[model samples]
Every structure is written in C-alpha cells, then in structure tokens.
Target: MYFFLINLSILDIGAISVTVPKSMTNSLMNTRSISYTGCVTQVFFLIFFVGTDFFLLTVMAYDQYVAICQPLHHERVMNRTACVQMAAGSWASGVLNSALHTGNTFAVSFCRGNKVDQFFCEIPQLLKLTCSDSYLSETGVILFSVSLALCCFVFIIVSYIQIISTMLRIPSEQGQHKAFSTCLPHLTVLSLLVCTAWFAYLKPLSSTTSQLDLVVSILCCLQ
Candidate 1:
C-alpha cells in the first residue's frame, strides 16, 4: 500500500509539473506561446505520468484484493521483488504508451495553426490542428488507450467483487467497516480518474474550441 501510494503521489507530481509550471509562467508573464519542442515534451511527459497513475491504481487495487481476500499469502504474493517489478512495469508501460502518443501526434502535419486551444498540449487539441490523412493513427492510439482503461476498470471491479464477498464472510461488523474504509477511497479515486479521462478523450471533438471545452480540459488536468 505504501509503495503504490508513494509511487502514485510521485506520478501525480510529475503529471501536474509537466504543464502547470509552464502555464503558470505564461500566465504571470503575459505570454501565450509554447515552442513546438516544448509542447511536444509537455505532451510526452503528461501522458507518461497520467498513464503511470492509472497503472499504479490498478496495481493498488490488486494489492488490496490480495490483502483482503488472501491474507495468508499476502506476504508471499507481494514480496519485495514482486512489488519492485510491478512498480517498474507500471513505469515502463507509461513510457512506452507516452512514446507512442508523442510520436504519432508530432508525425502529423499541423496545418491549422500552432496555437493550442487548451492550456496544455493535449492530444485532442493537437489533433485538431493536424491536416494530414495520418491523423487517424493518433485516433487509433486514443481508442486503444480507452480500451486499455476499460480493461483495467473491469479488473478492478472483479477484484472488488471478490473482496466484497470475502468481507461479508467475516463475522465482525468492525472488520467489514475496516475493509470498506480502505477500499472506498481507492474506488472513488479510480472512478474519478477514469471517468474524467474518458470524458476528456472519448468525447466528440469540436471544430471550434468553446468555453465548455476549456472548462472540461481544466477539470481533466486538475484531476
């Protein structure tokens, strides 16, 4: 639990740091400009951190599932080596996913303009500016990401189902409460993260940016 939480906190800091610092600097300096390379870098690390966050959440759910449902083998199942490998795998997945996104996004020709409608260099906004026929490649990447997220969501749900069943078998009301207390917050955070991310990425793209888009984009970032 501590391993996943600490990794998640670090990922959150990295994710927000990717774009927030630049946005704040621009706000204070009265500038609306980010260089092409800077925008690409921002998009890369943002996706990396965000992807890692989701993976870590999934790991944490599995960790809890093992702890609650198979307490006898918890130590054996989640040994130090296993924990390190899981954490490393999460980071690797994030890096590879981010590389795919960054490569596909920048490979497109930006004929519309360099100006991004959102505060950060988001994929959807970048796609809006793309003029080449290859934009569908990036769309495919988004679809794949959404599919992976759904798979993770399903995995968590299944884990929780077993967890709930196991909790009910426990005779003590306090034990149930203790188990629920540990799981509920993780569930809430996962729901918010997945829902907001899906809302941001899976929604229909608008040809023209609107106030609503800005609001939704901000909400996604803050999450």
Candidate 2:
C-alpha cells in the first residue's frame, strides 16, 4: 500500500500545484486575472490529477481489501508488476479523461464575460461562461465523468463491505478492533472525497459566485 500511497501523495501535490500557485501569484500581485492559456492549463492539469487521485483511491481500496480479506493471495495478486500496471493505468486514464473534458470545454464559445466564479479554472465554472447551447457538449462530458466516478465509488463500496465482513469473522475482539481502526480512516477519507466532489460538481449553478464555492474550492485544493 505504500506504493499506492506514494502515488496518491504525488497526485495530491499535483492537484494543489495546478491551482494554488496561480492563485498565490494573483494574490501577491493584487491581480484577479489569469491568461487564456494559463486558465486552460489549470483546467487540464486540475482535472488530470483529480481524476487520477479518485482512481488511486479506488485502487487503494482494492489493495486494502486484498491484504485484509485474502491475505494469502495478496502478495501474489498485488505484486510489484501488478501495482505498477495499476498505477500507470490510473495515470493514463486521468490524462485521457482530462483531455476529453478540456477539449470539450474549450470547444464552446464563451459569450459570457471571462471572469471565473471560483479560484481555479474549474470545469463547472468554466461551463458557466459559455453561451447556453455552446456548453451542452461540456455538460455531457461532465455527465460522462460523473458516471465513471460513480462506478469507481460503487467498486470502493463493495470492497469495503467485503473488508468489513472479513473483519467481523475475526475471533478476537482486540483483533477486530485493530482491523477496524485500520479500515475506518480510509473509509472516512473516501466519504469526504465523495461528499465534497458530489456537492461541488452537482450543485446548482448561479449567476453570482457563492462564498461556499470559494470555501469548497479551497477545500478541494487542500485535499
């Protein structure tokens, strides 16, 4: 799992780097602007890292489930080659997904003013800038991404359910406690990830930005 954790840490850093530095520079310069290319770059890398991290979390769930529920096969199934393949697959998937969203998003004409509602070039906020019909393709992209995410979420849930069942079969209460402690934190993190993202992309759009949007965007970066 350390391998997966390392990948997760890298993704987290990438996610933050994509958005935070531009915001910090703007703050220091007392400017509230980003170039067209800069905004596009932000949208691409932000989506890339975010999508990869979500996939990594799902992989981590499978790792934990194998390690705890089927300890005997864990080493054989999650060998170094397998781990590398999984990590590489996750990164590739992220890049492909990011490319899709970024291309679809920028394909539309931004008839509305260029001012973004949130701190970063979030897809939803970017979509808001487009003319109504111009954004339909981007909206469809978001729906596709959400559906993919839902599949990952369901896989995570199933893994955890099996993990919990295995933990319950432990004879010792102390053993069960130890196992539960290890798994609960991961579950909590997944819960937070799902909740924040669901509220974020699925929430109602507005003509004016909400303070909550700013707060949530900050929280997303901090993740």
Best by TM-score: 2
Clash-forming residue pairs, model 2: none
* Model 1 residue 130 CA deviation in Å: 0.9
Model 2: lDDT to the true structure: 0.88
Which segments of model 2 are wrong by more than 4 Å? none
Candidate 1 off by > 4 Å:
none
lDDT of 2 at 175: 87
How far residue 147's Cα lies from its native spot in candidate 2, in Å, is: 0.8
Tens digit per residue, CA lDDT, model 1, 1-223: 8888889889888877887899999999999999989998999999998898899899999999999999999999999999999999999999999999999999988898788788888988888888858699988988898888789889989999999999999999999999999998898878888777877777898887888777766766666
Clashing pairs in 1: none
Please list the Cα RMSD from the true structure of every candidate, rounded to 1 decimal place.
1.3, 1.1
TM-score of each: 0.96, 0.97
Q: Please report, in order, the local distance difference test score of every candidate based on alpha carbons.
A: 0.88, 0.88
